[model samples]
Target: MTVDRSMIRVKAMLIAPNEDTSAHAVTLNVPTAENPEGYHRLIGGSVEFGETHREAVRREVHEELGAAVEDLELLATIENIFHIDEVLGHEIVFLYSGRLDPLPAEAGATLTESDGSVVPVVWRSVKDDADPLPLYPTGTQDWVSAALTRQRP
Candidate 1:
């Protein structure tokens, strides 16, 4: 699995959990050959050229959820390498924990992606034992827990 330096993608994500820290908001990703059962992922997108990850997080959150990110704190940086539908992928993820200025409804709300596709932002349990669908970027479950608990590992 040799990866050229240029093939890796850089992105940022926010772990904006509810006040009680039991759950966090995520977007449902369509089922693929790699994850036939599908998965849930934190809200965010790629880090655009010339912008920092923090900027990207703010922009992504606002664009996707129509809300501002406040009290932002860097949680972790994860190197995610996987295959989606058999195509290899790699990414450098700058993860953060923050509060949404104008929070979305508890019942959930629809968000529009940069590609114009709309999806719902649903809150899911941070407890892996509780949720059926796995949260992505794989090994960051602990980071998610830190984000919800305001503790860094």
Candidate 2:
């Protein structure tokens, strides 16, 4: 018997702090029509063709934030077996954390909106039990908070 399956796609959870690294905050990029709705996430993306997770992390940082990041390390991979619409897929999201030495200002971060529009980005401090905006994937708010407190591998 053959099992029909959808290939597992790699996801990225990019994190950047305030210029002073003042607090442990994160941002989630909005998506646009040109790109897949769920695909245009925050300063992160797929592993790309023939790219290592690290390389992809670096690339994603520059592409999304237009800045260089250091000390990037994997955090979590919460398997979310759910559908956005009627599509069957899995979010093998590979969460990575790093410091953007020269973090960009909120005004500079541009994300594609759902209606094919470029929108500005903002950093929300994941500090404490407050709920993050709906931009983030379900279960992400808690997972991120937990990852921040976990002992790095």
Candidate 3:
């Protein structure tokens, strides 16, 4: 039998720290007419054809966040498989840790998507248990925890 691999998507994501390194920057998914009950997610996007994971991460950040990142270090590669609206979805995720010069202010910044949706990029403490914001792509919390611990003195 022939195999169909069209369902698999490759995504590159970044874990970026705030200026003080106290928290990481994440996008608050604004609910649209199409998708209500929005969620939070890291800043990155799909890897385009002929693009390296690092290159994709940099390009995505510039497109989404309007900033350039440096010293990208691959932290994790996650095989994410789940169902969205009863449709099976799979993604090969490349997670990277990097530093952004002149990081955005504590008030955060706004990113406008191609579809004209405004997404807020904010810094949140990874260790905050009181905040009940839902972060996506399953296994991301564990990766953040480990990254933070590694940066500790």
Indicate the residue-level lDDT of 32 in model 3: 40
Best by lDDT: 1
- Best candidate, TM-score-wise? 1
Off by over 4 Å in 2: 1-7, 19-42, 85-88, 111-117, 128-132, 147-153
The better-scoring model by lDDT among 2 and 3 is 3
Clashing pairs in 2: 29-42
- lDDT of predicted model 3: 0.77
Show the lowest summed lDDT stretch of 10 residues, model 1: 1-10
Question: How far does residue 127 in candidate 3 sit from its true spot (Å)?
Answer: 0.8
RMSD of 1: 3.5
Ranking by TM-score: 1, 3, 2
For model 2, the local distance difference test gives 0.58
lDDT by residue (51-99, candidate 3, tens digit) is: 9999999998888777899878899898888655445668899998888
Better of 1 and 3 by TM-score: 1
Reference-based TM-score, model 2: 0.65
Model 3: colliding residue pairs: none
Candidate 2 — worst ten consecutive residues by lDDT sum?
32-41
Please provide TM-scores, in order, for all candidate models, with all chains considered together. 0.91, 0.65, 0.82
Q: How far is candidate 3 from the true structure (C-alpha RMSD, Å)?
A: 5.1
